[model samples]
Target: RRQFLITRIYAPKAWWFGFCSSVYSIAGLWAGAALAIYAAMIEHKNVAVF
Candidate 1:
């Protein structure tokens, strides 16, 4: 949300709660369909949630 500058009020209209991660290699979704969410360390990196 920070990266996209999305507000809490905008969340319901902008994003959904049910969508989860998909394998890029296997799912083959569009470029704007997925967003990364960081887990632990910065080096460990984020998970793609669609």
Candidate 2:
């Protein structure tokens, strides 16, 4: 059926998948790094970051 156009079937979902996969990858990395820095610099007082 024309209603099942391939582009329409995959385009938006693919874009969302790409954004979620890539952006979440970096966001999660930074969030984890920040948590580690907080634990080391503030919680454990190992060194200075600010």
Candidate 3:
């Protein structure tokens, strides 16, 4: 009974980790895209000012 309860508790934690991993990956992708766009905008602005 003790082992069963421990397993049940960890099962949800395992699922939570999986869900968090996907969310983290998606956020990382968006951050990368935003950085790229910002860099392009800076380059364009410099060109226009020069």
Candidate 4:
């Protein structure tokens, strides 16, 4: 009975870990894309100002 309970608790934890990792990966991708776009915009502005 104790073993079953432990397994049940761990099962959800494993799933949660996977879910969190996927979310983190997606967020990192979005941040990288935003940074690239911002860099491009700054470059364009600098050229225009000069």
Candidate 5:
């Protein structure tokens, strides 16, 4: 019974870690995409000015 209790707690912690990591990865991807778009827009404006 003691071991089962420990296992139950550990399982949820592991699941939470997996969920958090996935969210982190998705956020990173979104930030990277936004940065790229902003950079492209700036370059476009610079080209037009030249």
Candidate 6:
């Protein structure tokens, strides 16, 4: 049927879009955490030196 064909075409696109967005969000969170930890470490070192 025409509806079935249309659903098949769009389903994968929707799934792929969701998958990519989730991956991007996860990577962004990881990068943010890493930057926070690095900044804290640098601050700690500076405090100890002074």
Clashing pairs in 1: none
Model 4 regions lying over 4 Å from their true place: 1-10, 44-50
RMSD of each: 14.8, 5.7, 6.9, 6.8, 6.6, 6.4
User: What's the distance in Å from true for residue 41, model 2?
Assistant: 1.0
For candidate 6, give the lDDT.
0.82
Give one digit per residue, the lDDT tens place, for model 1 in 1-50. Answer: 48555554567644344233335533655433342222333445434521
Off by over 4 Å in 2: 1-10, 43-50
Clashing pairs in 6: none
Candidate 5: worst 10 consecutive residues by lDDT?
41-50
Q: Candidate 5: what lDDT?
A: 0.82
lDDT of each: 0.42, 0.76, 0.81, 0.81, 0.82, 0.82
lDDT of 4 by residue, 1-50 (tens): 99867866879887678789999999999999997888787987666433
Q: Looking at model 4, which ten-residue stretch has the lowest summed lDDT? A: 41-50
Query: In model 2, what are the clashing residue pairs, if there are any?
Result: none
* Total clashes in model 6, counting residue pairs 3 or more apart in sequence or in different chains: 0
lDDT of 2 by residue, 1-50 (tens): 67547755768787678778999999999999998868875765554544
Which runs in model 3 stand beyond 4 Å of their true positions? 1-10, 44-50
lDDT tens string, model 6, 1-50?
A: 99867876879887678789999999999999997888777987665433
Query: On residues 1-50, what C-alpha lDDT tens digit does candidate 3 reach at each position?
Result: 99867866879887678789999999999999997788787987665433
Cα lDDT of candidate 3 equals 0.81
